[model samples]
Target: MTMGSGGSSIVVPRNFRLLEELERGEKGIGDGTVSYGIDDGDDIYMRSWTGTIIGPHNSVHENRIYQLKLFCDKDYPDKPPSVRFHSRINITCVNHETGVVEPKKFGILAKWQRGYTMEDILVQLKKEMAAPPNRKLVQPPEGTFF
Candidate 1:
């Protein structure tokens, strides 16, 4: 495995063996939806990832493919990754303060725990998008395409 900069050793827990698979470029266990990639820095950690969720199988998002992005920190595995929708999502409960998509307005990202993983977060986000608590909300303003 690639070592972290500054000579600081990265600790891996035995329970989360998937981390090793990720480090070795193996696909996630059970669900291939979760994957990893290196960012511009070439860090050995799963700094970025992408996945698609099939709506909710029967909900509004059913049959719809939803894209997602996961940003991992240097101290990953011990810290939850920040996940966001790669595609446009219409929701009115977003946090104006952080400019993040907060459908529940409960600030789930802000309350992330170290035990969380990219797969875990993506699963939760898919569930929320499929059956949003506030379905009547309008989509966020679209950005101009260059």
Candidate 2:
């Protein structure tokens, strides 16, 4: 088990899969939908990560850049990481006050699989932004954070 930033503890097995995540993050995943890296590059056990998602083409979110932070605890992979947006966004799946994604509202978080990487989550979110209900809604100013 390992401790998180705020004194939270999580279980970390021998096959934590963190190294796998790091390599995947560094090498770049396909689709060009998103990109992520350790928040503090020097730390391989990288608990904090920052991600960017390119707004979908020809949409209200087009040409916009969304920034997010993902916190992976020792229980990550086994349990979904805590995801928050440093950029303000009004979507059903996100908590307005905390910027935390709602696992129940976000399918990937509720039904997480080990094979799913942070890229999958970002791509899925970009898809969600274009979803019918979200697509029509006006967004807050860019760079506005929660």
Candidate 3:
């Protein structure tokens, strides 16, 4: 189903949620560490979205904006989407090769719930950045791409 058309029953609800997410982002959330939206701006289903997570203050990731991709497939809202990083960094949950966050290692994704929005995932990742093991790890040089 094409996203912009909203003609498919399969994608209708997903598109609605995505639209809500975009609007929520435009209104702005209080946290300075995260933001997200439709990747290309024209897709209504927004199956592919781009998200940014700022490094938590005082943590190794501080001052850095990590780029991420979130893919919500047909089963979305019932199942969590897949996430990958475009920016390089040291994080325990991330796969070094694929850049995909391992659900087994990443609690938020592992424990993802249908009601959770992509925003929730981004914030959870921010928390992970401040998490003990990750917080103290040496950071890669900024602007590094994976």
Candidate 4:
């Protein structure tokens, strides 16, 4: 693993960074509300991932489980992954018809940094579900997919 601290600039190679993320995903994150894993075990490049987010409480999305697809291309880490919801949702940041998360509408992906991980995206999305504008928005029927 590459380490950078203070004024130093060190970049972790793609594969090493991806392995670290994979391990963390398997371990489960805080509160167990969001999780992600490799989409295909045979994919040596680890390009695709599946993410799950349980809707936050006290919101229109509450108790709903949302599924998403994330694609980490060759420039991953340096560039944000493409994210799209497989499960239909009605949120300000997500496109209504396509289920894609529009970077222009989502600050996290639009202002992505090299250190951000798939977990960050999932966690942030969960938070978005609780945001004022999205919290009360009417959502599609449960278990419906794009």
lDDT of 2 at 142: 85
For residues 1-146, could you state the per-residue lDDT of candidate 3 as single tens digits? 23354554344476787777889977776656698878777665678988899899878998898999999988887788999988987899998877798889988778877678889999999999999999989877899888
TM-score of every prediction relative to native: 0.57, 0.82, 0.87, 0.95
Off by over 4 Å in 1: 1-18, 21-43, 92-99, 102-108, 132-146
Candidate 2's residue-wise lDDT over 9-52, tens digit each?
Answer: 87555245676666887787676668898888676666898998
Candidates sorted by TM-score, best first: 4, 3, 2, 1
For model 4, the superposed segments whose C-alpha errors exceed 4 Å read 1-7
**What TM-score quantifies how close candidate 3 is to the native fold?**
0.87
lDDT of each: 0.51, 0.82, 0.84, 0.94
Q: What tens-digit string does per-residue lDDT give for candidate 4 at 46-134?
A: 99999999999999988889999999999998999999999999999999999999999999899999999999999999999999999
Angstrom error of the Cα, residue 131, model 2: value is: 0.9
How displaced is residue 98 in candidate 3, in Å?
Answer: 2.1
Q: Across residues 1-146, which tens digit of lDDT does each residue of candidate 1 receive?
A: 23589987665553344455356334443454334433433544546665555555544554555565666666565655555566555544334334355634534455666555555565666556545564434544443111
- Any runs in candidate 3 off by more than 4 Å, and if so which? 1-12
The C-alpha RMSD in Å for every predicted model, in order, reads 7.6, 7.6, 6.0, 1.6
Residue pairs with backbone overlap in model 1: 90-139
TM-score of 1: 0.57
lDDT (C-alpha) at residue 135 in model 4? 98
How many Å off is the CA of 128 in candidate 1? 1.2
